[model samples]
Each structure stands twice: as structure tokens, then as C-alpha cells.
Target: MITFCRKSFIKNVFNGQIRCKSANSVSLSYNKITGCVTTSNDSLPPVLIFHGLFGTKNNWKSISKAISSKTGRTVYSLDLRNHGSSPHTSGTDSTLIGMANDIELFLDDNHYKTATLIGHSLGGRTVLQFAYLWPERVEKLIAVDISPLPTIPQQFFTKTTFIDELSKSIENISNDLNMSSARKQVDDRLKPLITDAFIRGFFLMSLHKNEESEKLFWKFNLNSIKHMLENEYINKIEIKIPFNGPSLLVHGQQSDYVKKDDYNAIRELMPNVQIVSIPETGHYLHIEKPNHFIDCVISFMKLS
Candidate 1:
């Protein structure tokens, strides 16, 4: 059985039935609707995977299936709110805490007493926030290519500037044009800002056809995400307590997101964390080195 909350909660939010004074308001009660694709086999401890920014559950489909088959544990790849098929939210509800709350509701609605969380980039921060807020609910945690630091130091470019440029490029794609032309136009505009073909292609995945208008549009809630990124996601995480559960921090050798200097700080927060670095890979380690990524996850899960 697919255990998830009814889609009504999302509808209510979209209809303006739920309102809050601030983004930090705790009175908000409706479940933040999310989309997930799962591979199950009546497994005891399920693994929930969360994708990074501009990514959806589809990005992790093959990985989730492989993990499920090899480890004999159910694997779920979730589309965080405002991304993929998940419901979009605005204002305070788009913050990191809000995202964590959504995950909490997901677990509760599904009757999952505890789960092992695997998150990449933005999703990594979400799972970390979730574990911090509700340590008892997480059996384990795996953060990929992200640090628990207050701000993300620049690697490819300034994070804010990069996202803003990318957003503009996406917006520049003409809606009236055919998908192929729009893609070409988007690529042309993004070429100067983003030189890497792989990264540009990754961002392009968010583009989809609008059924009514027959136009290509972004599946993600770009405005909401931009707001969150500026106000919360890029800032330092405020955590009250550390998650003592078994934790794994995986980084790519070619990635600068997780720096050597940050290890002590990460250890201070997650004492049980074991750090692993995959060679010759960048921020998207899972995509660049799927076999190594899968092996690391499986090996970690098998540990007694």
C-alpha cells in the first residue's frame, strides 16, 4: 500500500486556506505535500532519498532501485516541496524548517516510526535539519557533498550569483517557441554563465511542457526556491541539538562543498559520522560515480 497523506493538504495550502504571520510561525499545521517514487519489498528499515536543488525523485530512480535490490531494504526517492511533482508553497512555508516539517509529516502519515535518510545538496541540509529537530525519528543519516556550515563557500561560482544567473537564463527561454528551440535558446543564454555541459543539462531537466499552453516551463517553483535560498538555505543552520545516530558524510574529491577544514565542525555536530571521499568526482558524486556511491551506502548500511 502506498502510505502517504491525502493530496488535500496541498490543495488547502494552494487555496489560501492556511496562512501564517511569519515563516518561522509554528502554528502552521497542514502537511506540506511531497511526491515520492518507491521500491519496496516489505523491508523493515526503509531508506528515504532526497534530491538536491533543481533535482527530482526521477534523478534517483535507478539508484533507489539498485539499493533496494542489493540491500533488501525498501528505498524511497522523494521530490521535495516546490520540486518535481510535489506541491508548491510560498512565504515562511518554503523555509528549511518548513521543509523538515514536511518530511516529519511524511513519516507520520506513512506510519514509519524511523527511517534512514539520504540527502544530496539542498536535500542534505533538509535531512540534517530533520535529524536535529527530531533525532528519535531518524535511524541513520547520509549527507552527500554538503557541509553543515553556515554558508556555502564558492566553488564553481558565487552560489547566489550562480543561481540568479541560471534563473534568468531559464526565464529567457521563450515560452511560445517549440521545446527544441527553447532548449537551444536556453543553452545559448546559459553557455557564458555555466560552461559545464553536464551542469547545464542537469538544470535543463527541470523544464517540462505545460499541457494547456503547450509551452516548456520549469517544474520547480523557482521563485519560492530563490526566496528560500536567499533567506534560509544559504545561511547557517540553527540546530539546537546534534543527531547522535549513525551518520555518513560523503564528498567528492573534486567537490569543494565539503572542505577538509569543516570536518571538525561536522564531527562536533555529528560525533558518529564517518566521512568518505570518492575520487575524481565533483559535487554530483552519485551521478559521476554511481557504483562507488552505491557501494559506500550499502557498506555503511551493512555495518552492525
Candidate 2:
């Protein structure tokens, strides 16, 4: 059911100490917002996961763990640069293609001739670009609740609305307050729009204590993310090759990201793309309806 080729694509990229279970293992330390996670694993086409804006590898832990346990395959959830553990580099270099290159290099370094890449929101765009660049390297691609086309971020929360809420929450946080208290304050402010308690909690988790100043700062580089908001979300990259690999494009029936107009272009780029619409869910379809998301993935992976 799995075909893992044991061959080195790019040798000596990392020290020879980068061990593997088979010859098909390459490890690449990707530098992003925080730092990097060395990804190297066994046969069974590995699942490379990418998180959305304001998310980290930790966000994908639940679904990834479940997927790995159910399928017995290696699942890699990456924290894109400027968002999670990946180290933040100067400038807002958050191009979709550029981010995909990091994954490509990771695959090359880790001996994985091909992989199943799953991404959500901003990450969906990144994965699309990745497959566009290296169609042969992707065995399967899953895009959750987002397409390559531009969508309005303000739909989540109007600029004035988010700013006003954040400002009020910031004012409540004192030097003496604990993370729990700070999170509670922020949660109270975000409650109206972000109904999911778990997501609200996850966002709160990104807030870290500054050891020196004793102030709380977000782990993600907000500046870099904000800077690329316009440039990164646009539908600029055209797929040169119609990626013939198995593709699953899952979207929420309530989400505006994947509109009817998108179908022609999506099918044009990937003639084999399959679309699944999860009803009663919005942009955060996976998080809003985890079971449905898992079921769709399981059914698709089992096929062929």
C-alpha cells in the first residue's frame, strides 16, 4: 500500500548523523517564525501538515495524532516561519511559493521522494504553491476550508472590532497578572466573534511571558504576518503543470473562501481535484467540525 524509495536526493545537506529508518529519509531544519523542527520519518508516504495564520504545530497535534494512530503513518505538522516555533527572519518574506520551498527542501533532505501535504487557510495556499512547484514530489494534497484565491480576512472580525477588543483586553492585563488571567481577559473580549472556546484557548497559548520585562508578548512575529497579508493572499501563482496527483479540497458550505467561481480555475489547475463541502461550518471547518474532517480524510486516504 506504501512505496518508499530508498535513495538520497541531496546528500550531505545535513551532517551524516541524520539517521533514518530506511534509505528514504531526509531531514531539513526549516527556519521560520520561531526556529525549526527536524522532520525525518519512516516509509508510508509521510503527511506534511501546515497550519493557518495565527497557528502553530501544536494546533495540528490533535488531528495529526489521531491520523497517525489510525493509519500508522508519520505525520509532520509544521509551524510556518513568523507563526510558530520557526525562527523569524528579517523582512516580511512570507510568499506562498517561498514557504513551499522550505517543505520541498525538507522533503529533499529527508529522503522522502513524495509525500501527502495537508494544509488549512493560509497554509492551503502554501501547499497549493508547493504542489505547483513540485507536482512529482506530492503523492496527495489536501486543502482544508481555503483556496488559492484572495478572501477577506476582515470577515472574521472587522478591523475596528478586533482592535477595540484587543485594546480593551490589553488594558486589563497588568504586570502582576498570570497567563491564565491574561487569557481569560482576552477570551472575554474575543468571546462574541470567536465562539470556539478551544480555539480561543489556543490563541491565548501563543502569548508568552517576557522573562526580562515580565510582560506578555505573542510568540508569532505580528509585524511579519501583517506585512505579507496583502501580497501573500493574492492569486498570483499560476500552476504550470496540472498536478495529476490525488487532491482533496475540503471547504465549509458556509465559508466564502471557496466560491462557485473558484471551481473552474481549481479544476483547471488540478484536473483531478475533489471537493468536499462540510455543512454548518465556516472558515475553520476542521476545528469547528473535527470528526467530519477526520472522516473525510480517512475515506479519501483509504481509496486507492
Candidate 3:
């Protein structure tokens, strides 16, 4: 069973006073319901946000709050299973279908019969799978910075190497006695593998001192995520029926994740899809251009 944090606890997390913790024992079921940080109100058809791989609900806090206030609707930012404050399950539990089922449970647990789903990267794939499996439950769908292509072996290998190196760097940093030293050591090690400073900073956001362990560790389940990225996340989606809901696909113009060639396949699965591109940004378009991203979402959501 998933339990929400008290409002005070949620506030502490936002203020950087404490790391998020699970409020109750996590279920080991395949369709395990995950935790969430919500900006709720008595609004119909809430907007549900799902973060990318190696990301947490914390990453979307500001965005969620903004969207909630702007749209006059509740916004639920979720920590997909094995990441953030959610339960850490095996790689098999990290498959697209498994993640989609988690979303289904979340909606049911919260008494939400329908919602607008917004997801980024791996989360995007999850929402797409959810729309496919439970089309009637989705009011709308928005996918960010991802394509529906099968796993490319070379691309998979490249990402695997990066994640492996990153995990090793974090493990080494965890052994350092001094927090400052650990931070420096982690940055030094990551600088070589991740050239982009922004990307490096983004990854560091997952690093936090675990109160129980009394050591610095990644908030995400790195090993499980690595396995999922290698075996499940990159694989091609094989769904025959398309989700006929109002759908929007947002891409970062500078990112190759959603290229021109992938549009046909996207359109094939989402016949009524509207595509939007944010310029001068990469895969993390929302982070790089928040205003444009929000504008695109608002415009798409308002369309009749």
C-alpha cells in the first residue's frame, strides 16, 4: 500500500531539510504502486507527471506547482518505481508494462478515474504504454524527448557504459568520510564521462545522505535502472492498437531522441497526435527552457 507523506514532511523535502522517505512498507507486486508529491485541489481530471530514468518527483516540483496554479488543476508528480522515494524492485519490474500498471494503481488508489498524463523520457514510454493498455482512463497524453523505436544495440551499449561509470563514481564517493570531499570526488569523476555540466548537475541531484545508512547514496535504484535501460527500456514497443485520445508529443529540437524519421511511427500509433518542438534545447528541454515547455503544454491542453 502506498501512503502519502504528511504535508509537513513534504514541506521539509521541498525546503531541502530532509530527503523523502516511504511512508509505509512497499509492496513487492509486479504492479507495485509508487509514491508521489502532489499539488492537489478540488479540480477535475488532474495532471499527472512522471519523471525520466534516474530522476525523482523532486525534479518536477516547481513545474508541477506552476502547472497546478496555472491550469487550476491538481498536479501529481510521481516517483516511478525503483526511483526516488518509491520501492526498489528488480529489473523485470521496471519494464514499460510494469511501470504502466503502477500508474494504473496510483490512479485507482487516489480515486482518480481519469487524468492527463505527462511523462519525460522513460516516463514518456510508460505513459504511452498506459494509454495503450487503459485508453479509457486517460484524458490526454503528453510524451517528452523520447521515440517509440526499438533498442539500438550500439546506443544501448553506450548508455550502459555511461551509467556503469557513473554508478562506480557514486559508490567511490560514498566511501569518503567528508561530505565536501565526496561531492568534489564525485564531480571530478563525473566530469570526464559527462562533459555537459548541466547533465552532471542533474545527476548529482539524486545523490543524498541516507539517514539510516549514514552514507551518501543515489536516491534511485541504479542497478535495477541500469538493467532496465539495457534490456527493457530501449526495446521497441509492440502494440497494435493506437490510443485515440488527444495526445501531444514534445521534443527538444537539438535532441536526436525524437528525430524526423520517427514521426511516421509516432503518427502510426497516435493518429491524432500534435507535435511540438522547443528550440535550442536538448533532451532536458523543460529544464533548459521552462517557459517554452510550459507554454507548449498549456497550448496543447487548451486545444479542442
* TM-score against truth, every candidate: 0.82, 0.78, 0.82
What's the TM for model 3? 0.82
Better of 1 and 2 by lDDT: 1
- Candidate 1 per-residue C-alpha lDDT over 227-272 given as tens digits, one digit per residue, 9 for 90 to 100: 7756755454668887799999999988878977889998999999
Write candidate 2's Cα lDDT for 179-263 as tens digits.
7776677678778867878767777767777787767667776655655653443355556677778999999888888876688
* Per-residue alpha-carbon lDDT of candidate 3 for residues 147-202, written as tens digits (9 for 90 to 100): 55663324432477777776688664455366667777788888878777877777
Per-model C-alpha lDDT, please?
A: 0.76, 0.70, 0.74
lDDT of 1: 0.76
Name the candidate that leads on lDDT: 1
| Clashing residue pair totals per candidate (backbone < 3 A) | 2, 20, 1
Candidate 2 has a TM-score of: 0.78
Task: Give Cα distance to truth, residue 30, candidate 1, Å.
Answer: 19
Ranking by TM-score: 1, 3, 2
